[model samples]
Target: MMLELLSPLPASLNLGLVLLSALTSGLSAAAGIGGGTLLIMAMAQVMPATALIPVHGMVQLGSNGGRAAMTWRHLDRGLLAAFLPGVVLGALVAAWLLVRLPAGVLELCIAAFVLYSCWGPGWPQRLLGRGGTLLAGALTTFLSSLVGATGPLVAAFVKQHFAERLPRVATFAACMTLQHLTKAFVFGVAGFVFRDWFGLMLAMVAAGVVGTWLGLRLLHRLSDQRFDTLFKWMLTLLALRLIWLGVKRLGGA
Candidate 1:
């Protein structure tokens, strides 16, 4: 079933989409942003709405999984351990709600929540304790499943905790991979077919690997302050985009 849809796409188009998705994924990874948001938006226009979440999840699972594997040595095991259960629980709840809920409203809510988390006040900074990490994991994972990706939100939380650059990026990727993996499994059980899209998925994965390698190389050259500044502005812009999307949906509704 999934294969039939993929088989119709021209080889060139498949390759092109994969390369494009990969570049974005790499940039997102380098900046500690999740790539799923962009992938979902792009795929949403072309694929059935029902399939977009699962497909995006599978592709991101591959992309983030690769990034996590490459940077495994730098992962913060303590943080990962603390956050995993919350993320899993969030993903499960999100999966159950995916089909029944209004996705537009969900996305809007996610966008608003992320905006608050990123720029609301000094509260987030002050609240940056053990409890915050667990809450961030659960909330971000749940919202991520609903909206496709909220990398900037997760990145913001990570930056608040980890002062170092490399460990922060690696740790965020690991956490995101876990989230994406959970999303993929949930969507699979919900009846999103993957076998049919295997070829397309593979191409996207290959491109993502190359892009991640390039991004990692670039990461090594960036200064801590520079990365921090870049991340702040990028997240601000992402917040605005989400807000705009929400407004658009509201107007349409």
Candidate 2:
């Protein structure tokens, strides 16, 4: 029965991913970042190249949607409002250009930016404002459309504006939900057959919701100081991974 429900993928792998969904979702909920990036990295190891980005986006959509709904009250409305328009514009631009950036180069640039954001001075207040949010939404969405995991970049940018954990997590979830939604739509238009993978996606999402609930509980127990320190280090490690992947890719090229 379970095998039929998640066809094509081996039963063991399917079950493992469902569990990974829960685990990564919990990681994001408690830590304020890294879940989506980690999930994509894992999926890339097993999923088909053509289906990887779109499938990953759909799974993330479900995970972030659940997170956003759970903490809706804490979301920063003004920033979200400004950021959303950029998401739409970025999607349009990416679809129009149909450009595929060299994965290695893009990864390296993103890693650099993420490292700077994590350890360097905060962006000026003006840059974290409406105009900046709009630009960020567009750029991150564009990059996500190409690369599939911009969670670290988005999280690094979002962290600059909010100090508290709940608002940051909530707002970041909301932002990612839209970004992944747009990516799904773009890939759908480009003719990816989503239905074939729907069953697996649904199962993964269900697992993620359970994980999110547990993660939020953990989040509540964490001190602000601890959360900040953990969040930065988590991003730093993820960034380092990106740098490694980028270098490996470039070397191969």
Candidate 3:
């Protein structure tokens, strides 16, 4: 009932996972990409399918919350306003259908989209208008609810709109935090058994704090262009992996 198949591992293992999540989140945050994508993938290997979204959402909620707080001054209020309504609507829909949706299909679609976005010419730059940003938020939130982590898509959209490096990182972090919080609330409402995962969540949050601090420092030292290039390639690889996993799941199904 508690969703643990084997016994819970030692605290050390949990700590290591949390720290790894934190490091990944921090790097992803610093690079102006969302860390939730990596976090969810890593967690999915351990947590039950039913528990994945809520657990990942809570940890990411904390990770992004911290990053956003650290970069609050650079947030774009107008952009945030335009994005919120769509995100709220998307979150509602995603929560309702999460359990019923064919996850393999959903994940495959997401992976395809992400791959095209990365490889397709000028897609990110072309989708930088107010309308595009709002749509990006809605789509990203919807995909995130079902897939557990698709920060790269949102990051691509935000990166295009915000020319300044710091503003880009800050705004992306803020937007992702909002999306993750919405997801956590939706999962809670849908009865995702949060009470049993408190210890794991706490460990992740603590690691996130440390990782965020280090990432912020590293972000300041890196060149924006270099980070952007690296981020795009990283996203492409992640997308490929998702596609592969989706294919495997579909085969099994």
Candidate 4:
């Protein structure tokens, strides 16, 4: 049954993705960021751009949903409430503007956004609270519909509101869960055939659940100060690779 379910993809690729989902979800669970960014980049290598964003959104919905559930006690309800309206607006706008874009252009866009989020200056303080979160929710979710990952930007913005690690991580996960949920709805309305990819997405999400559990445990054990440098450099490398892939695709075309 399992083999037949995964028949659309080579067994090796299916298994690899399952493991990658676990690792990335765990990374996000522990570090409060990076998992979605890494997972999408890895998927970009094997998946078509047309299918990439929607599939990625569903997988992340499961991953972030799991993290949010695990850390439910730490969620900041006010921030989440502030952010919800913007998510709805973003989803509406994304649905109206949805169009098929070339893979290379999409890849370059994702790479550019990832790079900017990594090194960009902090958002102005005026934009850090309820007002900022509303804007961030709209902008990030809009971009997420196009690109697949905006966790870094969302994380940075969310960070400004909390000092303690658990609250930060929990709230961020909750925010992402809302965003990805909307993304999934938008993609479905836009005519993406999610059923074709359901088996793989389910497997990946299950793995992400395990990773999220392990990651929450690790979060309690590790210090945020230690991951700062490594996190930045790793994202930079991944973004650079996406840039190369984008250029290569454009050149070939």
lDDT per model vs. reference: 0.70, 0.82, 0.73, 0.88
Candidates' TM-scores? 0.77, 0.81, 0.81, 0.93
In terms of TM-score, which candidate is strongest?
4
Q: For candidate 1, what is the TM-score?
A: 0.77
Q: What is the lDDT of candidate 2?
A: 0.82
Query: What does candidate 3's lDDT look like per residue over 158-197, in tens digits?
Result: 7777678788888888888889889766787777777777
| Tens-digit lDDT track of model 1 for 92-156 | 88878776765356446655655565566533685466677778778878887776666667777
Clash pairs, model 2 backbone: none
User: Which sections of candidate 2 miss by over 4 Å?
Assistant: 4-7, 98-126, 223-253
With candidate 3 superimposed using the best TM-score fit, by how many Å does residue 155's alpha carbon deviate from the native? 1.1
**At residue 42, what lDDT does model 2 achieve?**
69
Cα displacement (Å) at residue 52, model 4: 1.2
> Best candidate, lDDT-wise?
4
Q: What lDDT would candidate 4 get against the real structure?
A: 0.88
Runs of candidate 4 exceeding 4 Å displacement: 1-4, 224-227
Q: After superposition, how far is residue 123 of candidate 3 from its true place, in Å?
A: 4.3
RMSD of each: 4.2, 3.6, 3.9, 1.8
| Candidate 4 lDDT tens digits, 168-221 | 999999999999999778988889888888989999999999999999899878
Ranking by lDDT: 4, 2, 3, 1
* Each candidate's clash count: 3, 0, 0, 0
lDDT of 2 by residue, 16-82 (tens): 8889999999989988887776687667557765577788889999999999999999999989999
